[model samples]
Target chain A: MLLQINDVNKQYTNNKVTNTVLDHVSVSVKEGEFISILGPSGCGKSTLLSMVAGLVKPTSGTIMLDGQPIQKPGKDRGMVFQQSALFPWLNVEENVMFPFKKEMNKQEALQKAKHYLQMVQLSNYGKHYPHELSGGMQQRVAIARAFTMDPKVLLMDEPFGALDEQTRTRMHGELERIWLDTKKTVLFVTHSISESIKLSERIIVMGTRPGRIIADIPVTLPRPRRFDAPETIQLEKQINHLLKEEIDKVVKEELSYAENR
Target chain B: MQRIGKQLVFFVGLVIAWELIVRAGGWTPDVMPKPTDVWEAMKRGFSDRTLVYDLQASFTRLFIGLVISLALGTALGILLAKSKTADDTLGALILALQSVPSIVWLPLAIMWFGLNEKAVIFIVVLGGTLVMTINMRMGIKNVPPLYIRAAETMGSKGIDQFIRVILPASVPYAVTGMRLAWAFAWRALMAAEILSTGPGLGYTLKYASDFGDMSLVIAVMILIGVIGSIVDLLLFQRVERNVMKRWGLETN
Candidate 1:
């Protein structure tokens, strides 16, 4: 396994009430595999991804990458957030080169930034400020910034959740192309079942209120799956059905807890 | 061109109103000088080189004091932001000092440094440092955590991360603080010079007031206002606009 999350647990305590966010969760990701974690809101899907990215630590388990236990965030794992999160003070090229501090000379960093900007089809926008760009373009710049670091694993948390349906669909296609071209392992978190089914080779469904993986389904759709394809529509419906059942269970449990309180 | 035209019209209207007020109020020449009288005094002061010397003296002290305050205040701000212990120990002291008027320290400064440039510089530093420190601290604190996280994931750590990521990102705040500090320092220096009787525009104005030469005093006041606006518009404002434009932080 390129990455292994073993018996991970996380808890948050406020005053005297202890809320367990993740419980006895384990997952293994193979090299170059695209995996999606699908769940309802507050299901701790983001928490799990954060642990694997080393942004947060699991309370009682080890996350190992390449046989080494992860302790902190490093250059080996790239992360993309729902918001663009580009530094407003920096132009497109400078924002992309922000992570290239190890380079001895600024020229080298600029050259590297140019290369990545080209890869993202933003070469003409090197001097453009973040506010000048559209939402999709800003997110593209963010994606280019993450990939500039050349990390082995890419962790995305609802990276397209903020966009409208039309933009989101277009971004889904763009992301697929990038994934195929890069062949980097990705662990994506989202609430959209169709998004997960559309992007991932394997989908991990999570249940809420002490979140845990309830279903781990492998997808066998052919390469370059079209959004309007009959097979894609059928698979999306199947995933939607499974998600509805999990969501219903979560809602019922939430109502019972509220009544008890 | 249009903006300049508008500004010119406003200025001409202001001068006309002031001239009319002095004429209509029946005020003695000792109390309020006519606009023409003040202009004549300004030309005379300029020709004698007294105005130039006083202006230069004040400008030099203002620049030096502001520079020192900016450097020290930014360092202190960063330290306070990075360490809870520093904030706990120094935060209250900073607030207390800032609340005190800069003029209140003039007598003590004069006593300590004598009636010299050092006294004025002392006042400038005290006035500038408080605002600089507070503004910079807020700026550093306001930096988004996600950007720091992103930098960390890119293998940036320690001082390297601070310089490359934190410092550059906080430029807008620091620049704004510096601008405010300059204004404070300017006003404080004038007040200090007025009391301390230095070779400055403030001293010159005081001398004119003592002689009941209202025209010279009025000229000096106008000169001070013009110089202040010039420094703000030509120097700080230009830099601020350029930086904010490049940073995508400009509202207009």
Candidate 2:
């Protein structure tokens, strides 16, 4: 196993009221496997990804990488956020080269940054600032920046969730192609079941009200699986059925709280 | 060029109006000098090299005061912004001290430094530093939390993160602070120089007024006004606009 998350739990407390954000979340990811954590909002999907990236710590159990426990954020696990989080003051090439500030010489870092930018098909935009790029282009720059770190795993929290439908499709294909090239472990978090099915080798479906994994379904379909394919439709329906109860539970809780008030 | 022409025409009209007022109001040239009289006084002062020395003296004091003020203010601002205890304690104290005018400190400054160059420089530094500290504090406070987190995950920690990410992100606010500090320091320098025995414009203005040389006094006042606006509007404001454009923080 490349990453082992053994029975991790997270709780947040406010006004002496303890809220369980995640409960008994155990997952084991192999090297170079693309895994997606799929769930509704408030299901702590992003929290799980954050813990793996070591941005947040679990209250119990341990998240170990290669048998050693993860404690804090490190260059070995690069993160890409939904906002694209590129430094506005830096140009595209400079932003991508930020991680290698002390690690590599200037010439080598610049060469590495240029290679990744070209891989993401943004070779000509090396001099352009983040504000000059479109939303999809900015996200692509973000992905290239993460890739330039040469991290052991990429933790992406809804990296393409902010893009439009057409842009999202193009990005999904781009991400798949990049994954094929790098073959590094990618632990992606998203609320989209279709995105999970389209990209990951396996999908971990989570449910809310004390977020935990409900099912771990493996995707054995061939590459370039169409949404209209019978297996894809069947898997989507199954996951939708699983999430419908969680959504209904949230709605009922809201309704009861309103009545009590 | 068009803007300059329009302003010049308007100014010439004003000077003509001033000359008409002198003729119509029956005031002596000693009491209210005509535009031509003031112009002649400026030429005499510049040719004699008196006003030029005063200009050099005032600007030298201003430049030194500004360097110390900007460096000290930026350092203190970062300290207060990053430390919770410092922000709660010293931050409030700095804000309270900022409300006290730079002129109000002159009596204490003289008492401490005994009416010398040090006293005047102290006032100028006090004038510039407070506004800079306040603006820089706000700049650091307003940096997006997202940027910090992004840098953290990429192996940037503590001081490295601050220099690489926080400092550059807060640049627009820092530029605004510098512009404000420049204006405040200029005003404070004039106020400080008026009391001190110096060859600065303020000192010469007072000396000319006491000797009943109304022409020299008016000329000195105009020169000060022109220089102040030139530095603030031409230099500082132009740099601010370029920075805003480059950072994509332009409102329009």
Clashing pairs in 2: none
lDDT of 2 by residue, B1-252 (tens): 999999999999999999999989988767999888899999999999999999999999999999989998898888888889998999999999988889889999999999888899999999999889988988999999989889989999888998999999899999999999999999999998888868899999889888888988899999989999999899999999978877778868
lDDT of each: 0.88, 0.92
For candidate 2, the per-residue lDDT at B148 reads 89
DockQ for every prediction shown: 0.57, 0.65
Docking quality class, candidate 2: medium
Cα shift from native, residue A250, model 2 (Å): 0.7
Q: What stretches of model 1 exceed 4 Å from their correct place?
A: A103-111, A253-261, B1-7
C-alpha RMSD over true interface residues, each candidate: 2.0, 1.3
> DockQ score of candidate 2?
0.65
TM-score of each: 0.94, 0.93
Task: Give the number of the best model, judged by TM-score.
Answer: 1
Off by over 4 Å in 2: B1-23
Query: On residues B193-229, what C-alpha lDDT tens digit does candidate 1 reach at each position?
Result: 8887658999999999989999999899998898889
